[model samples]
Structures are given as C-alpha cells and as structure tokens.
Target chain A: MSQVEELKSELTEKLGSDIQIKTEFGDDVLEISKDKVFEATEHFKSTGRYDFLMDVCSVDRQEREKRFDVVYHFYSSKDNRRLRMKAQLGENEKIKSITPIWKGANWFEREAYDMMGIQFEGHPYLKRLLTHHEFVGHPLRKDYDSNRQQHCSKAADLHFEDDETYVPDPNKDLIPLNIGPSHPATHGTLRIMAQLDGETIHRSNVELGFLHRCFEKMAETHEYNQIIPYTDRLNYCSAPMNNVGFCKTVERMLGVEIPPKAQAIRIILCELSRVIDHIVCIGANAVDLGALTSFFYLFNMRERVYSLFEKLCGARLTVSMTRVGGMANNPPEGWFDDVLETVATLRKGVDEIDRMLTNNKIWIERTKGVGGISSEEAIAFGFTGPCLRATGVNLDLRKANPYYGYDQLDFDVPYGTSGDVYDRYLVRIEEMKQSLKIVEQVAKNVPGGDFSIRDKDIVLPEKKDVYGNIEGLMNHFMLVIKGLQPPVGDIYDATEAANGELGFYLVSDGSKRPYRLKVRPPCFAIYQSFTQLINGGLLSDVISILGSLNVIAGELDR
Target chain B: MSTVPTVTRDLHAESEDLLTTAAYTTRFDKLVAWGRKNSLWPLPYGTACCGIELMSVMGPKYDLARFGAEVVRFSPRQSDLLVVAGTITEKMAPVLVHIYEQMLEPKYVLSMGACASSGGFYRAYHVLQGIDKVIPVDVYVPGCPPTPEAVLDGVMLLQKMIESNQPRPWKDNWKGPTQ
Candidate 1:
C-alpha cells in the first residue's frame, strides 16, 4: 500500500469513527490527536513509511485552548511521500522527543525548545542550540513581546543545570575543536563546537545566531513588497529564488493569478539565480579543496550573471522588485536576446570548468566517497535540494508539486545514487544545465500582458497614474504607508529553491504585516544532518560535506 | 665593421632616449613608472555580492592580465591594491584594517560598489557605513554592483593616477571629471 494511504488507514483506525482525519489543501499532511502523536510517529517510523524527520517547528494559537501547536514534517524516501504530523500542545504540556528514532532530530528538537518554548520530555540533549546556555521564553510564541529586546538577551541567563544525570565526558581523550564564527570554512558566522577523537568527530554541536538579524520580526514590520528586499539577504547567492518564493506565497495568499509574461520572467530570473548559486558553491568548494584556479574560472562566469542581473534590476544583490501580485518592473525590450547571449557564454564557461574538474584526480579522490550518506539516511535526516537529489530521489518539488507553471515545462530531474559529496556536485552541475534549458523555454514562451496584478488593494497603482490622478496618488500613499491586509488565515507556499524546497509559512490576522512569518529554510534541514556526514570521516572531509550541502548561514540561522 | 649593428642599435637607443628626455624627465623616474605599471597584484577585500563580479575581472572573460593587473593575491602581504568590494560591516573593520596594514608600501584601495562607496540602503547600526572611514581610497566604482566594464575602467583610472605621478605634461593638464 502507498505511504499516504497506509498512514490514512492507520490514522482512521486510531481516531475512531466520529473524529475526522483528512489531508488538507493537497499538502502531504495527516491530522492526528495531541494525545496519540508519539504513538503515531513511532508507528510511522517502524512502518518504514517515513524515515526522515524534516522539521519540527511550532506555531502559537493564542485564541485556542491549546495555545501552541507543534508541526512535524516527515518524509518517507521509499514511497516519496511527505507526512506532516501536527499536534496541539497546551503551554504546560510536553511532547515525547523522537531523537531515539532519528539522531538528526536532536538539534531540531533543541531548536524548537529554544524558539518555541516547547519542551520534549525524552530528548537526549534538550539544551539551547541557537541561543546561549541560559535563555528563557521562546521567541516565536504568539504572546511573546515583539518590542522586547530582553527576550533575546535575557535567554542567555538560564543556566544548563548539571546534576547527577549529566555526567561530564568520562573519557577526556577527545580534543575540542571550535570550527568558527571566524574560521574560513564555516561559510558565514556559524560556530561549530566539535568533540573530536583524533581527526574524527565524536559529537558536533552547531551554534547559530551570530549572524541572525531576526528576519521574521523584520518581515512583520515591513510591507509585503518591502519584504522582498530582505529576502535577498536571506540567501544572497540565489536572490531571485527568494524574490519568487516571497512573491509566490503572497500571490497564493491574495488569490491573484499573474500574467504568463510575468511567470516566464520569474522563471528566467529564478534559473539565472540557480546557475549563479551553483557557480558560487562550486567555486567556493573548489577553493576549499585547494584548487584556487577553478574558483577564478567559475566566479568569472558568475560575474557575467551579475551584469545580467544589474541590467534587469537597478540593484544587484538586493533586487527587491517583486510586488505582492506581480513584478515591480517588466523586463526591458530585447532583454530576452541579451539573456540568450549570456546563456550561450555561460554554457561554454560551465563546459570549461567541467573539463578542468570532471576527471581531475585530486577532486575525484577528495569528494567521491567522502561524507557519504545512504538515501534512507538522507531522507530520514530531512535532506533536500541537490543534497537529497544526490541520494537518487527523483523528487524535485518543481516536478512533484509543480508551482509557478513548472508543470508545463519539459525538463529532467537529475539525481544521484551514491549520496556522496561527488554525487552532490554532479547533481548541482546537471541541475544548472536543466535550469538553463528551462530559461531557454521560458524566453521562447513569454507572452505579453500586464506585469503587476490589476487589483488595486494588493498592488500599488502605476507611477504615471499616481502622478496624474488624485485617486491613484492616495492608493500609492496607502500602499507605501500601510501594507496590504490579506484575510485572516494561514498560508504555506513553497518553491524549489536552488538549495531545496524553500517554503514560506505566513500567518495573517487581517493585519498589514504577517502575524507570524515562518521560513522553512532547506539549509537548516540539511545542516541538522552535518554531524552524520562528518562523524566517521576525516577532518578535511567536513569542508567537502559542508560545501556539498551548500549550507548558507543566512538561511540556516534565519 | 664587425660591431656595426651594435653601434647603430646604441645610436638608435640614445636618440630615442634623447627624444623621450626632451619631452619628459629622468630615466630613473621612467624606470619607477615601469616598475609600478608591471606589478599591481590587487588584494581584493571582497565582502558581498560585488565580490562575485570582482572575481569576473580576474576570470578569462575580462582577463585583467591584458593590463598587467591579473595576479589577485588574497594575502595583503604580497599584494599592492586593496579592491574593497561589497559592503564592509563594522565588525569587519579591524580585519580590514589589519589587511591594509599588512599590504606593502605604495598600496591603493578601490572601493567597488555603492555600499563600499557610501553605505547603500543598509545604512543601519552595524555597517561600517563607508570604507573611507577605515582606509584611504584611490578610486571608487559606484554602482550597486559596478559592471565588469566599469571595473576595468577603474583599473585604467588607477594606472592613469600612477602614470601622472612621473612628472609628465598631461599631469599639468585638466585633472579629468571627479569619479
């Protein structure tokens, strides 16, 4: 039987005849009772339906009797099914941690504890992961003060009380290595404290928030269109994906359909972003592996992409051009022709790089079997994007759940079986080629229409209209001052980002800004599985696995 | 009769030197100019997205080698110019200062982008605000991400700045538009 059906049958049997159990909004979710949650998860894992514990984040429902709801997203690699298990937990109640089933859940559970104040009773190590050793009050709770800076700083005061249960490391042989807040290979500002037994990682604890800007809080204050600029900073390498993801989520919430031309433009920009993102990863990875020459060759191509970006948007990295309903500006005339030229140049450049590294003895040796993880393990650990693709999962959200007209396009979902650093590299390289193909198709199929949605409530009026007409001026002023107010509801929309499934879950309470904005960053999921990839491997292998995963700190910490 | 070609070559070289001397200055000055022009390995203090574009400058496309500024040594110890690309944060100030201090004498700084030039829109509490506060700048390439062509132009400007120092007639001419 299929995983979803089997899950449904099991859930129905548990809930009984009166209680309703149904999948909502076509997402891979199965609603279950708060009491039977632990039992269901254990059954789900043993059934071999879902092995990976993708994310376990919570949302606050102030009005409900149970003020907090923990959302657990699980994935079954064998069936290619995603099961979201949500259980409403009262503020006083605690859930049993699933760390026993999946080792990767250790950090995720701690993060939930740190962010949402949700305690996991049986968690192995439930200490603060992102915040300091002595933090209090979850920052993500609904009633948590938005203006209170004390919550962030005061959280450091809560001490990790050591009693009889917490015995110090009995064997003091392992050396402690702090990877960085300043180290070169940590990517951004992530400091990984690892206990090592002579070049082999005994246990790795990832410390985040050194670079955290409180993006969710910032998004709450900013208007919908204004939020686009901030998204660029989140995953700066793949800026367009952030733009498209934010726009798509807002579009879904507003129930507005964009012009075909705008969709095509979004596709082209997203593909360009994907290509450049891979270029950055490949170049940085090559440099980390001691091949500095390839770094220059690859980054040179990324510069050309940057030029194209400049021509399209006034700003390059922070190209905050998307409106709630559609694009802020249409592509200039002859834009497609220029994109074609750049694509040709990039294709040749990519080939040159492939020639340099495809058979290079050092590269192959360093990356081939290094940081290898099986498909089952990857899925169990909630690996996504090229990292998941490396494990032979033909599950690109662009293909499996086709958003932004991806269903209409014909392209291959390239995958790998080995799930090693080398396989991840191959998957990204092939994915870039596929993205190029998609861009070509988009350029060919772009149609002519209004770029922005005509709905005045969601989008600002045209510049000409605002300048000439009083009514238009007032509308523009309102939009600039107070953002669009969507209906009071929650919407979660995702896109296949260059990294993985970059999902945005926005909760609206009839306000100009989001009541609660949660970004399901794929990097965070991939980062949770880092210790797994590096445990038995060499110290140098950490660089390879970290690069292969392409863990951008902005996305991970945010 | 045996050294006729050598004598002519000497005469040709002497006459060319005389012409160059009449038009300009001493041979010692000319040698200094030559030394400065041939070796300008720019140490790029690239921080943000513009750093990507700066990489392109060294890439095969623009090939900064055509103008003798190709060797981009990351170490400030071995380099001449600090190409400060992207936004420099306040926290990065000490490190950038240390790098600038490490660079050899007669170094130049190229603040590449709006953020580095002035503080782009990220003019918040933490940004270094402007690179000029930390180090003396030679040329500022103004753009959110200045195009590779603009970067090349900045390199040429640096060369001109160096060339004008050699006691030349053009140095007395109008100093070009303030970039």
Candidate 2:
C-alpha cells in the first residue's frame, strides 16, 4: 500500500471508522469533525508520526452550509508524507485551538480568526494578526466590501488581563523601546515592542501588519493569469519563485505537464533567485552589524543577476515571468553564457565576503550565541528552509518532495550546528554556493523546445499568431477574453522558496477566478517566533537577529 | 521694474539689477531655496517592493550621492526631502503623517512608485488610496515599483520646484495681489 493508504489504515485502526480519508489530487485528506480535531492532532504528535504542523488556513464558503473549512497541513519528518486534515465549521461555531500541541499554531490560529472570522477556542493572544485593530469586519469573507477601508488613528495596545503598567520603577532599570514601523534596522515595516533591562531584552511583542496590501483578497477577484503578477510582490527578493510556486499549484489543478525546457527555465530562475535572496540577507545583515564593505560587494553581484532578469523579463525587482502553463517567454539570446559568467562572478564575490566576515572577530562576537534555537524548538515552531536547516534539520522541500524536477539537479543541502544568527549567516553563504552550482549545471543543459504546454484551454496563443491569422485570432480571443477556468477542486502545493517553504492552498469553484487562495509564506511561520528568539539577547543583537531571519513584511502580512 | 517683460530688456536688466559693483543682491527666500535645492538631505520612507528599488538608488550603480542628496537621515527632524518609497496602507497612513509632520518646514515630499502615487493596482481595503490622502505629495514617480532612474527623476523634479520657490499654501508667502 502507499504511505497515504497506510496512514488511512493506521488512522482507522487507532480512531473510529467515522473519519473519512479520501485521495484528492494524490494526497490523502482526512475529514474530521470539530470535536475530534484536538484528539486527532494530539495523536499525530504523541505517536511521533506527523510531528510538524506545516500550515493552518481557513477557507470561507459563503454559499455552503458550513461557512468555513479549517485546513491543517501535517507532515511526518520520518516518513516524508503530508496528511491534510480538514474540519468544517458553521457560521458561529468555534474549533479547538491546536496551539497546545504545536506552539507554531498560535499565529496561524490568530490569522484565521482575524481574516475569515473563524474562531479558534482557547487560543491565547488571539487578537488581529494581519489587519489592524481598527478593522471592523472580516475582509476575507465574501460579503465584506473590498473597497471599504478603515482608517486606524491610534496604535494598538496588546495588554494582557493581569498585566501591570509598562512604567519603569526607580529601583530597576527596565524600559520599553519601540523598534520600528519605519526604523532603519527593520529593513521594511516590522515593529517590535521590546522591554529591556540594561541592554538585555526582558519581554516583547511584535506588530507586523504595516505592509499588508491585501494580496489574498485581491487574488479572489482576479483571474488565474492576472494573479501571477501579484504573487511576484509576495517575496519580492525571489519573484520567480513565487510566480512558479503559484503557477505550479494551478498547473497541478489543470493536470498539465510543462515542457522540459520550461522546467529547466523555472529551476534555473528559482535557484538564481535563491542566490540573490541570500545575498540581500547576508549583505543587509552585515550592514546592520557595522561591516559595510560586503554590502557593496554583494549588492554589486545582485545587480548582475538583476541584469539577467531584466534580459529575461522587463522588470528588476518584480519579475512576474511565469505563466500558468509555462513561462511567459524564453530567456534572451546567449542567456546560458550570460548565466554561467554571472554565476562564476558570484562565486568570487561570495569568497570575498567569506574572507571578510567568516573569521572576523567582530562578526563572530556579535552573531555566535545570539538568537540560538534548538532543533526541537525550531521544528515545533514550523521553521523550514535555511533557518530550519541551521538547527540541524535536513528538511528541504526540494529534497523531501521535489517539484519541477528539482530532484534532477545536482547540489548539496547545507546544515549547521546551532540555530543562531551566525549559523544562519553561514547557512545562507553555503546555500548560495550550492545554488550557484545548480545554476551552472542547469544553464549548460537546458532542453530546447516550446515554452508553453499543449493544453489549448490554458496557454494563450502567441502574439504573432494572434495578430496574423483568423484561426489564431479566434483562439486568442477565446482564451484571453474569457479567462482560463479549472475544475471544481482544491489543491495544496509547496515550493522551497529562498526563505523557506512557500505553500499555496488554492480552491477553485470552476470559475475564472479562484474561490480562495491562501499563501503560506515561509516568513510568516519563521517570523512568529521572534519574541522567543530574542527574549534574552542584547539590544544590538536584535538588529542582527532580525536581519538573519530575513522576514519580508509583504509575505508575512499577506 | 517688477512688471517689465521685454525679451532683451528682461535679460539685460535682470542680470544688471542683481549684481552691484561690490556686492551681490538677491532675495533671502530665493537664497534659502537655492541652498535647499542643491543640498537636499533625504529621509527614505521605504515600506514595500519599491523599497528594494529605493535601496538600488542608494547602491553603487545608480548612486543617489551623485546628486547632493546622499545624506540619508533616519530621524525625521534632520531631513528635508521625504521620499515616500512604497505602498501606504491605512494602518501605515497615520505613521506616514506623523513622520511628515515631524519634519520642519521647507521640507518637500517625493512620492515614488505607483502605489505611493495612486495606490497602484491595490485598490482594496486596508490600502490607503494614494498617500496624498494623508500627506502632500510634491512629485509622483510612476512605476509599479519604479526603477531607480524614475525615482531620481522624481527627486530632480522636487529640486526644480524647490529652486523656483513654488507657491506653498501651508507657508505664509506673499507674491500676488491677493497676498
């Protein structure tokens, strides 16, 4: 039997037979009731089978009897199987919070409650996670007006029930410091409320919705093809990854396999994006640490990669270069030579940075023991990608569940000893070197063929064909005028983004636009543990920790 | 002399009227505008995708230091040119306003990227429709995260406005009959 079938059989034997497990799009989804959510999740944890809670997102079905369907993505580290648990909830009914089992579920549960108004009972600190406190109704619900924006004047006070005032006493030297919504160290809009007692952080709260631009709500209204550009903004550092990740989710729904050349392009661009993303992280982290020369070296290399992207697409930062069926266009002429040369130059830049910061005393002193997290705590917090690997976990989506033929690529996954800021920086450097190798390998052997798939219902006709002949014009009109529609179903797909696992859970109602699209941004889960990571660290360590995390506010809030 | 507008007369008399034998004669307001335009200290209010592009302008390739505006100030009090560099949502609007208000007078605002100019394509809830709803935008650079070149264009345009001493409704300046 398949592992999914084995899981179903095991679940049936352990629990009652009333639970229904069915194969949907090749993965087993266990349909459980509200009363059994906690018990089933506890079983998954206690048995040490599915030890990680990948994501928790809720879908709003306004026309159906069950107003919301809370979906849980559970993964077993030992067996490499993903089990989906779905529980239906009515309009006002509450689902049991899974935070007790998985501490990572705290922010996810709060996000569901804030966006779709789905209540998670017994969830501590269950206030608004994305939208501001002044938001009136749930914006993700179908009935909520998309244009009805609320103006938030005052800042929110996240006060506990039994909390005393923040006023510092004369005896103690404790004080509260607000870090950012506009501070330079935040890189963007992450705000941290840190209570410090003589340079060490005592307690803190993080507010990170300042860059939320309503990406999910916008996707619900746009067609599948139009939504690709919006995905580019999610992880702006790695635009092609978000594009390919979203398009792959839709491609899975359509059941179409892109050409080999297209897969090669996707892999090349994804790895290239990973290299640049890490460059930004390392460069910016060094800048925050007061070592300024490496930033110019790394950013100069980043600009070289940006030039390649400019050649492929027209834009630099937000390159929405992938379509649902395949890529928007092929790489420019002599692209392989350009890519090989760029990767070779990037290696030299990497070496220069290594010499600058690897053994430098100041760099080591600042980042060695700061923000250290154990492997168990990292897994419990749903850390993935480089951050998780920094804690000694070898869980990369590319190795575990390969997509877009990432399995065929020849590269090594870098692991670190302790999950500290230094480990993260080292991991990023090693990963960039691996990514350079992968880019070099793929650029030499790109399969040449059509860039789009064979599905007529999906890919738009070429521009020459559309303007040339009558048959092509009619075909183009049919596809572009009316958008591409998929069958009625929901699918969850993930890609190993530069930051971590970027998952897209898309539900289609057989319409041009998606019924719901939930982007499980890697930054969201990794950034949720900020307070834990920097609880006892010094004030200067906060900047280094935040930089090593590389939390993009767009993806975190969206 | 104030109403004179003949072509040759305007050029000949204008230069002669400003220069004396021993000293240079000019208005103090125009002097301050000249000083402000050439030496614009900028505070980057970067928040989203355009932020990377903003950093690109700060990078070595498209160096903003080529102009006299390379001194990036973190505190609002020290800066004169405010470059609003990304999307301004409703939650961030008040913060944007607070920063703009904190800057002293004679400060100019340059709205970079489409989101800062006209909300871009994010015309949904939680997004403030154009940052002009909260702060006075002097120049609008138009791009979905505009290129560094475009951002520089906006900054140069703000310099021109500052040089010409454009009408400041918020400031008490007298130039016309109504004044």
User: What are the TM-scores, per candidate, against the unseen true structure?
Assistant: 0.78, 0.94
Q: Pick the candidate with the highest DockQ.
A: 2
Each candidate's DockQ: 0.09, 0.43
**Which candidate number maximizes TM-score?**
2
Model 2, backbone clash pairs (residues 3+ apart or across chains), number: 0
Docking class of 2: acceptable
Off by over 4 Å in 1: A1-9, A15-33, A48-52, A62-66, A74-84, A132-137, A141-176, A194-205, B1-179
Question: Per-residue CA lDDT of candidate 2, range A1-558, in tens?
Answer: 977677777777877788688878876799998888998998898888898898998999898998889999988878777888999999989999999889999899988998998889888767887888788889999999888888888656533223434554557646868888888889758888877888998888888789889999999989999999899999888889999999999999888898998998999899999999998889889988888788778889889999999988989989999998998887788988999999999999898998999999999999998898999999899999999999999988898888777788888999898999999999999999999999999899988898888566898888888899887888888888778999998898899999999999999999999999999989899998898888887899899999999998878886
How well is each residue in B1-179 modelled by candidate 1, as lDDT tens digits? Answer: 12111112233354656444344334565556656866788876665667666767777778889988887676677889888876655444545666677888777788899878886655433355676776677888987677778999998888877765633342234242121
lDDT of each residue in A1-558, candidate 1, tens digit only: 964566577766865543344554445655566776777777777876676666677777889998887877776545546666778889899888888887667767887888788889888778766544434566666666544432221111211223213224646646767665444566535556666788887666566664444567667666677788778877878888898998888778777788877788888889989999999898889888899898878877777776777788766566776767888888778889889888988888888888898889999999998888888787776778899899887778888777779899989989999999999898888888888888888887688888877777888899899999999999989876777888776666778899998988777888887877778888887887777678767888888888888877657765
Evaluated at residue A533, the lDDT of candidate 1 is 73
lDDT at A457, model 2: 86
Candidate 1, residue B80: how far the Cα is off, in Å: 10
lDDT of 1: 0.74
CAPRI grade of model 1: incorrect
